[model samples]
Target: MSEKVSLLTARIIDNRRVAPAHFLMTVRLPLSFATPFPGQFVMIRNDECDGPLLARPLSVYGFQRQQDHAVMDLLYRVVGQGTSLFSRMIPGEELCFFGPLGKGFSIPTGVKKVLLVAGGVGVAPLIFLLHKRLLPADGKGIMETIFYLGARTAELLTGLERLCGFCDLKICTDDGSRGYHGPVTGLLKHDIGGFDAGDTVIYACGPKPMVRAMGNLLQDAPFHCQVSLEERMACGLGACLGCAVAVRTGEGKTDYRRVCQDGPVFDLRDIVFASPAGP
Candidate 1:
């Protein structure tokens, strides 16, 4: 069946702003909601009369199951007219959304260290990964997960305090208000030395510039890096051809791949960034 078959109306259980422009919405999905992997996203649209002509695609942050009800959480920022409309939605409102879409992060055996990188709202998928992997209810976590979260300012760093218990957390603010000033990459540089490159892997989700930097830094290193890309997508599937990512080939060639299908997550070395952040 088409992935869209997973489509169902999600009833809002709660929706509130976490920061000046960031919002978190808790919603209950139908029993048939597809199980989504870390790094996957959903296309959503609320029941509105006008504007926001198309659905806005968002990352699947986290989910829980209570009795027979399944609850999913969405973390979003008000950046445009579409997201602005999303912020206005309140509890008890229903929004049409579906997911478990796109390719997600992967872990091979013998990985002892998992490094996660997030900037701004990039915390969404990484948080889900922490729960479903490192902090699973069974408490059988094998790998040590570390997070390096960054934002422009302290006020822009979302959910830093609440997620500290899940993993080794490090915070960076560009304007020197948080744990470290400058880039999160600086923190990684300071800490990456402690990890064995061969046994370490990286997962990053953030702006193009940040993801691109990661690709450049670890491309030739022993670390296996996977990056979750952010794109403005029309359809949550490949049918729209709206979200294309540049991929690098062995023969000095670049291939355009669809982010909604080929991946929201991909091997860092495979990406050909527009402006290469060379190491």
Candidate 2:
């Protein structure tokens, strides 16, 4: 019940300049706060406390809900110290956000094929689960999402052309400049072929060694992957476990999960990564 702190009223719909430190701001919110799902996150602050007074989560890239006004979208990348002070905010200037914080991205009732792996700015919360229609290509739906999306060039793959009307999108770039060249787990080990594993349901975010290499390429690929992690959080909530991680059990034993309230979304065979000075 600590996840409801509205105060939106934002506005900045498009602040381009994508690449070379990247910047793509788009805001419009006012209402729509009914549990901001789809890999939820938001907890901004660029002022009202001198400067970086904590709160700068981001993600949750799209949300509409109209009937007055309710927009939630953000795709930021300026990096270092609270987004370089939110890249010197302008275009109307009035941000002091609260969240649709933590826990989200798991609405695939029944599953047919839902692969969404992102890297670099983690494609901002999988573009809010591809616009939350929950996959509806006029087929009655139970889940059929596809999106590879990677980055390292082509200006860090900014927003991928607004997600190309949801899913079945792919792109990689390490040095080839755009769309399929190298890393993106080497284009998911040469195009996973519509992903196998009984029904498919892989989800991923980014960096942490590409979400531990998409959890070791879904460990034998029977589908059902999930991951969304990034460390260095202070307290996105879960009372400062300081973004703990390292679950991995099944007699292999290794527990300690709490990336801001039990997860930043886990279960890619339940994480493990810690090493490098070993926590």
Best by TM-score: 1
- At residue 55, what lDDT does model 2 achieve? 70
lDDT of each: 0.81, 0.72
Model 1 TM-score? 0.92
Per-residue accuracy of model 1 over 78-152 as CA lDDT, tens digit each:
999988988888888888877768887777788888898998899889888877766667654578888899998
Q: Which run of 10 residues does model 1 get worst, by summed lDDT?
A: 1-10
- Please provide, for model 2 over 13-121, each residue's C-alpha lDDT reduced to its tens digit, 9 standing for 90 to 100: 5666676776767666765565577777776776644766677777677777788767666777777878877766767766767677677757456667777888877
Best by lDDT: 1
Prediction 1 global C-alpha lDDT = 0.81
- State in Å the error of residue 2, model 1: 11
Q: What is the lDDT of residue 178 in candidate 2?
A: 82
